[model samples]
Structures are given as structure tokens and as C-alpha cells.
Target: MARSPKDVSAHFSDVAEVYHDLRTTDQEPIISIKNQLGHLLYKPSINAADIGCGNGRYSLLLPQHLGDRLRLTFADKNRCMLNMLTKRLDHTCSSEVIQSSAECIPVCEKSFDFATAFNAVHHFKLKDFLAEMARILKDGGLLFIYTRTQEQNRCNIWGKYFPDFCKKETRLWKERDFCRVVAQTSQFALQDSVYFTYRRVSSLERLIEQAEGHHYSTFWLYSDKSFREALDRFQQNITAQFTDPAKIQWTDENTLFVLKKIREAR
Candidate 1:
């Protein structure tokens, strides 16, 4: 079951603490994420925004060579994540923060140079969010959306044995189709869709911790119990399914869609 807005808010509020520690850059997933986003992240124009900037992973990893070139905004509905992100920055770049939802960003039309949303697109109301992204960016601006592919898995054996979990997770990204709709309706051009594969070896404990940090442990199947107990069951199910293999091989693959705003016909 999808969490109620209140519950999701509360979980992320608690999740903000130790968020960076739980999903450290040392993790394999981080390597994959950085490689996908490497080029698009230059210094922003005078204005930019990071929507759904949960725990600010993308905010923290903004490229080094760009140097204090563009004003930046970090926006999220969860105060906890925003607070954590605020403390993480080094204070060199020009930036501001906002508490807002992606579906209805609290910004004026054509107000930003560019916008970036990483790994959090699935959480928004798509039609409204797409319109909001289009509304906030200047003519000829850009938006970068990146996310891991559904095929990536923590335990191949278990993913093969019990595919329902994978189905549930994969379904969340069906919004990718809405990207096309957004492009057409919002007067943006589909510049390019790029695929990148990244690999790193991580300990099982670290892998579980990263998953828990995102609250992936609270799938619909286990939501009736406390999140802790649900987590145990989630771990147990995967462990039992992959019992023959003492240590499982995990892979994370991602796709990025680059969209550019074009001047709408006058």
C-alpha cells in the first residue's frame, strides 16, 4: 500500500537524520548515480531548483568544476530532509531553500534557469508535476530526470523466485511514459534519453541499510506490522529465497531522460 501523505512525511522526517551516512557515496548505487548525472550538472544559470531533494544526495553531489556560477534552490515538502540538506552544504554556492510539493511548486512561471529532480519523480502526481516543472523554467531551459531501471536487483535468485516484489517496485516508474506527455504538453523537447550501467561491490549490511534508508522495506505486503518488523520479514524473505547462494550478486542500472524547454510558439 502506498503510504498516506502524513505517514510518508513522518517516515522521511525520521529518515533525514543519518540519511547521508546510510547511503554513503561509497555505495555502489552512488557510483551508478554519479555516472548517469555527471555531465548535466554544471553550474546552474542565475536560478535553478532541485525538486524532491530528499536528504539532498544530488544537491550534495553537484559537480566541482562548475564553481559558484549559478544560484541554486533546494525544495522539498519534508522539513527533515530539507534541514539535513541545509546542514550538508559548504556555503560557497549561492542558494536558497523552499518547502513545496512537486505537483504544485510554489514558484512563478518561467522563474528558473533549470530544474533537476533525481530519483524522486515516482513520488509525485505526474500530470500536475510535469506542468509545474514546465511552468517554473525559463524558455529554452532544461530539466534532468534520472532513476534506476527496474531490472536492477538486490538478490537475483530471490528476484527470480518471488517476482511480485519486483512487480510492485517496477510499477512505480510507469510515470516514465508521462515524460513524453509532459514534453508534448509543456512545450519541451525530448533532447535525449541515455542509459548508463554502473557497478560496485558492497557489503550485505550496507545494501540493506541503503534500502531501509529509502523506506523500501515497507512494501505493501508488510505494512500491517511495525516498520521494523516489516523490515525483518523483507530481509528474511529475500534470504530464504536466495539460500543456496551464500552471498548474492547485486546490480543497479539506471536511465536518464534529458528534456529541454523550447520557446513556445508565440
Candidate 2:
């Protein structure tokens, strides 16, 4: 059920044991999703699914916001990610972790009252994924997708400084792409598209360590030689642009596309 070896999931599987060690502990994107949901999940009892719930990062933090009444289903393509998540989920919440791809979820129809995909939509086949979501979500159910469009990617520190950083990554979908596809689905209506920019501060040494760890899936796109060259160039360029290497600051942008099921699956 795993994606191709070259896929980001494969890279993640290789480092699944230590993935958390390299990850930015507090991802603003995850926090933003919860913050947005805080208003909508008012029901005393709720059933939700975290599609592409890699390593259950969102699943763990979600209960604080959702409370014990929340029932969660975590689905992902990587078994390793699911396994890691299982060990961490003991008595955390009423949860189930399943290994499944986004385009085809092995679940009953209208099973989820709320569904979400965070920073993982790029790995899915959009048409099929949307249809699947439509099938699983009850009428009027909500789906929140947190992702960065290509334009946003270009503005990130890596894309600005690292040579070919944006060019090497082609998996991202633009805001218009999501809008058009959602329109075509006819099962759900795009509710809102919210953009967020977070100010990030990290030291140069920490930045290099993250880059060397291939903290982002984008780094795996380059060959060893190219990555080394880009890393050197990135280091030189950033240092030349700023005097204080100890406190490097940049802004990262992401978008959340909110959609609601307008009608039952066709």
C-alpha cells in the first residue's frame, strides 16, 4: 500500500523512526486547522477522520481542542507511519489508525461528519480524492485542506535561497486548481480559501541541520551533488543578504481550502 520509493512517503518511511526529531515541533499549519475548527465542531459528539494522518501529529494535538467526546479515524498510506502513531495513541483518544491511500479510502459511505487533509493533498490524485471525500462525508459535512500553493512555495526561504528549490518540487497545486476541481466535483462547494503567513525564526546552524536531514520532502528531489551545491549556494546567499546569521527570519505562507458537502455523492 506504500507509494513509490521516490515518493515523499518512502523518504518518510526510511526515516520514520527519527522523523519527529527532525520535524519542526510546532507547525503553524496544524495549529491553524484546529483554531479554524474550534468554531465549527460544536456538537457534543463528533466523528472525524484525519486523512493522510502521517505519524498522527494532528491526531495527538487534536484531542485538546476536540475533547474526549471526539472519535477519530486516522488514515495514511504508510504502514510505518501508522505503526509509529499507534504506540503514541494509547489512551489518548477513541481513535483508529488505518493504512489507506487518499484516492481510495476503505470506509463506508457517509461515515465522517468532519474530514481533513493537512499538508498531504499533494500526494493524492485530486479527482479521485475529492470523490472519495464526497462519499465519506455526510451532507453538509466539512473538509479542511491545509497546503501551500506553488506561488507560496516560491516565497519560502528555501525557494528564495536554494537553487532550483521551487523548480524541483512539482507536486503542489495552486489555489485556482483546487477551486476548479471542487467546482467540477459538483458534490461539494468550496466555502472559503484562507491564506496565512507565519513569521519564522531559526538560526543558520539549525537551518543547515534541517536541510541536511532533508526535513522537507523537497530536498529528496535533488541528487547528492545538486543538493550539496544548492546547500553551499543557499548558505552563501543568505549570509550575504543579512548580517545577523544567528537570528535568521523569514515568512512562510500556506492556504486552507474549506469545502462543504452541498449534496450527496452522485
- Highest lDDT, which number? 2
Tens-digit lDDT track of model 1 for 1-266:
45542244466676678766765342333344334444345534457788999877875556343457756788899998888888887778888888999888777899887677877776777677777888899887777777654554433422443335565454346435655576557467777666655554554565566655654422433343444464566567657745533465554455566778778788
What residue runs in model 1 are displaced by over 4 Å at the alpha carbon?
1-7, 24-45, 149-164, 183-186, 211-221, 224-248
Where does candidate 2 stray beyond 4 Å? 1-9, 25-40
TM-scores, all models, native as reference: 0.76, 0.91
Question: Looking at candidate 1, what is the lDDT of residue 143?
Answer: 78
Worst 10 residues of 2 by lDDT: 1-10
lDDT of 2 at 152: 98
Report every candidate's CA lDDT.
0.63, 0.82
List, residue by residue over 44-67, the lDDT tens digit for candidate 2: 878889998888776577777778
| Candidate 2 clashes between residue pairs 3 or more apart in a chain or in different chains | none
